[model samples]
Target: MTPESAALPGAMHPTDQSTQGCTANGEMILVVEDDVELLELLGTLLKSAGYQVAMAKDGMTALESVTRGGVQPDLILADFNLPGAINGLQMITQLRMALHRSMPAIILTGDISRLTSRDVAFEHCVQLNKPAKLKEVTFVIASLLAQQRNAKNDSERPGQFAPGIARSSIIFVVDRDDLFRHTIRGVLESHGYAVHDYATSEAFLADYAPGPPACLLIDAHLPGMEGVELLHQLRKNGDDLPAVVISGSNEVSIAVDAMKAGASDFIEKPFGRSEMLQSIARALEHSQDANKKLAWMQEATHCIDSLTLRQRQVMDMVLAGFASKHIAAQLGISQRTVENHRAAVMTRTHSKSIPALARVALAADLRV
Candidate 1:
């Protein structure tokens, strides 16, 4: 069906009005699984939720569907194990490479123990144990789409800063395949992390700007820069980004190399869901620490000259927890003027709130 024909009866065409949700007309989701019954069930559930759905029996077919644009699924739900050469993860690496755009994704599997520590570390991706929970699936799909919409908007408006742990956190998936990328993207977003996906090391390096990424999950066997090389490049560029490497290969040498190149950890493919989550948590924690240090360094580097005398006074007072009105009176200035100075302090310090500014001020050798 043409894009218009795919619209729900009596519903606005996805092409017409972009809705507030991640999907405008309806988000397109590609369901890839060897099991016919599960695929049908997933399709039905997604359609009921107002999503445009497509299906593929295996990894290669899923890639073809994405390539043909028969349905450019905004997300993919894939089975980890598949019939032939390309498994779910392999396919994910492929499709994502073909289409540089990031799509949210989730992996459905029977065994959670199959995944390794490294596979679980990828950000904005999730895996569901077999005999899936429908509610969990529903929530995952909705959450990922919402994150995608927010990420797209944030990327477009680079200067707008939002305050919150969610806003500061980001997940990056460096997989070559599209279906796998989608599956993982679905999983991570479901767990509540903003995700940015790229198919290849080249693509990721070229397009990914330094921002709010909390951690990176990368496939070891990428087209251009292997995970080790990519890890090195990121560090060389002064991006102390934490990463976890997942590989189908079980070579000790490879694992060692990945770690040496800066991967926080390594996992062999076909890993369990629980393992993936645990690994990701570890990497995120590491990334968070690194980011905090970086933020402090940057704040300290800002020139004293950037702030007006009034701004400095306001910042110190705010850090001390004085109310705006109180600061105004103490400074013998109008509350509005004090508020303006407070805003300037935040702008200059890149602080989200008065407390955040105060913490930065305390860390830095503030002139005031």
Candidate 2:
């Protein structure tokens, strides 16, 4: 359908009362779908709500547009079933690599049963079934964009510094068995780890927030929303909290599913204290690595944001391995002038050498 024809009229429009509460403020959205009609409908809806929309018919086109720096979208809305080998999740991953940062995304699919925990494991990404209500879609988009804005603001706040070290050493245990919870809590507490035990997954999720160096010991079989599903939900919400799954039966399929759901490790029932401790140690180590990468990404983003337009151009050329003379010629300036801008770029980025400057640019995903 044509863009004009796809536009909803008056009361049926996105700007109507149903979606008025979640109006967009010029945030760019990249919509990818193989269906032309659906794609046009999404573009029109988003544009009507004040978002700048970019359309892609398939995953490859979306990747090419993002990597080529054609559009820097704030959020991506992609259909899971694409024509090519690249799916919605893979396209999001490629875009994240190009930007040198995680971007918010939502996967729209008709068959919710076909989706596995691994498909939506990306940070700041969620999946919605097809035929979703327009109000629901608008609310999710607004929430994700608002989260991004809040995170950026928090990073820029004064007196705020990235915590290179882990926070509190707390372990949360979620199991239906009272005896097991008591025994595990005692064992963990004896080993110098603070343990909080909950009777069900619901209780744990209600009290849980992302904080500190922590791990979750969840039973594989729970009354509702099994352990692996809980882990998947946490990961989808951008929570990097390490988790270990414990099951009564040593089923290989269960272990594999838990791992796919972002669990650090899986342990069979009747585990020893030493075994549990080892799993916790490994999970904490993984958390530390994630924290370090997050810090580096944040620092690189800040440094890149501090550069002026000319300085950014110079930095990009340097990263591209262009010599000062060639860069000056391309930019229509003298070689000495190029060197001056180059020096300023290095100083502002706090990069001592060409290689260091290149690393910063790469980490920030700046395209030349």
Candidate 3:
């Protein structure tokens, strides 16, 4: 149906209004969702809450409504999983670029986990999990629109800082169920992710590729190295690999154990497409963050490793909370020499203070 047909009479229609005017006010709301019933439901809900509401069935229609029809709303409440070339995320991104403004948005979806930090990083944007109550939805919409108005009033305030895009990573599937594992791999591959699978944790570890960013999706009841135990082992081995545990039962105790064992997320068996995708996406986002930290730590460690033996001794003593005079006495060196070595240690590590040096050492896992 066309945008006009989807709205209640005299409520929302194609606009002759400028994008600037629409963005400057909180008078209209654009709803983009594929579910017909939910679409009508939302239109009614928003109208009752005293707001003009426009509706679209998919992302392409939503994008065209704004770009071609000049029907940009002050706030967008869209579902992430839309049909056609653009999804909800793509449509919002395009709109932001086209309008040259960070429009307020509410990302309504079944899975918030699937979205990375960069995807919902815009100002006045909030994400709500699907099947939310109407009251809660309206509350978020009103809250964001209020913030938008406040920001517009400021006029000279700077926009929010947007982080760089997150890198997609490989997904490792460890499930003894051959059929289930195959199905999972097929789904993830179709979504454009690199995938690898193993029936046991031992096999996964033996052939693991440490150079690339990766996350694990393991069945809780494996033949050997039970899923939670595998997470425990990885954590014990100092591996911060993000993981999701799946089980046939939805036992609270099992989920608790998995979480305690360092699993990033947990899902019950026989999950649907959205469920699986959200879990994997959440896990991969964690993996991306872990990789970033790993990179920073490696660089810091390399810097620390370059210090001379005497400088290193001085650094260690400072880290141990030794006074400068005591450190000099122990090293059988003059206080002036000790001070010089300490200064060299600071310069080499790029640290301004003892605590700063300590953080670098701990983060890089160097000997303190």
**Alpha-carbon RMSD to native, per candidate:** 15.7, 21.8, 14.7
lDDT of 1 by residue, 324-356 (tens): 899988999999999888777777777653333
Candidate rank order under TM-score? 2, 1, 3
Write the number of the candidate with greater TM-score, choosing between 2 and 3.
2
Stretch of 10 with least lDDT, candidate 1: 154-163
Clashes of 2: 0
The TM-score, computed over Cα atoms with residue i paired to residue i, of candidate 1 is 0.42
Q: Candidate 2, residues 1-368: lDDT per residue as tens digits? A: 54423442211223232434455779999999888877878888789778999999999999888878578989999888899988886687668656745568888776555223323631236877666656667778988887787774432121122222213478899999786687567546545567889988899998988776788989989998899999999989999788888887755457656766777677765554445666676677657777765677689789989988988887777766678999999999999999999888888778765534654665565543
Candidate that would win on lDDT: 2
- Candidate 2 residue 35 Cα shift, in angstroms, is 0.6
Q: Quote each prediction's TM-score.
A: 0.42, 0.42, 0.38
**11-119 in candidate 3: lDDT tens per residue?**
2233332222222133789999888877887787677666888899998888888889998688888888889998786687667656655567877766645323224
**Each prediction's whole-model lDDT (CA):** 0.67, 0.72, 0.69
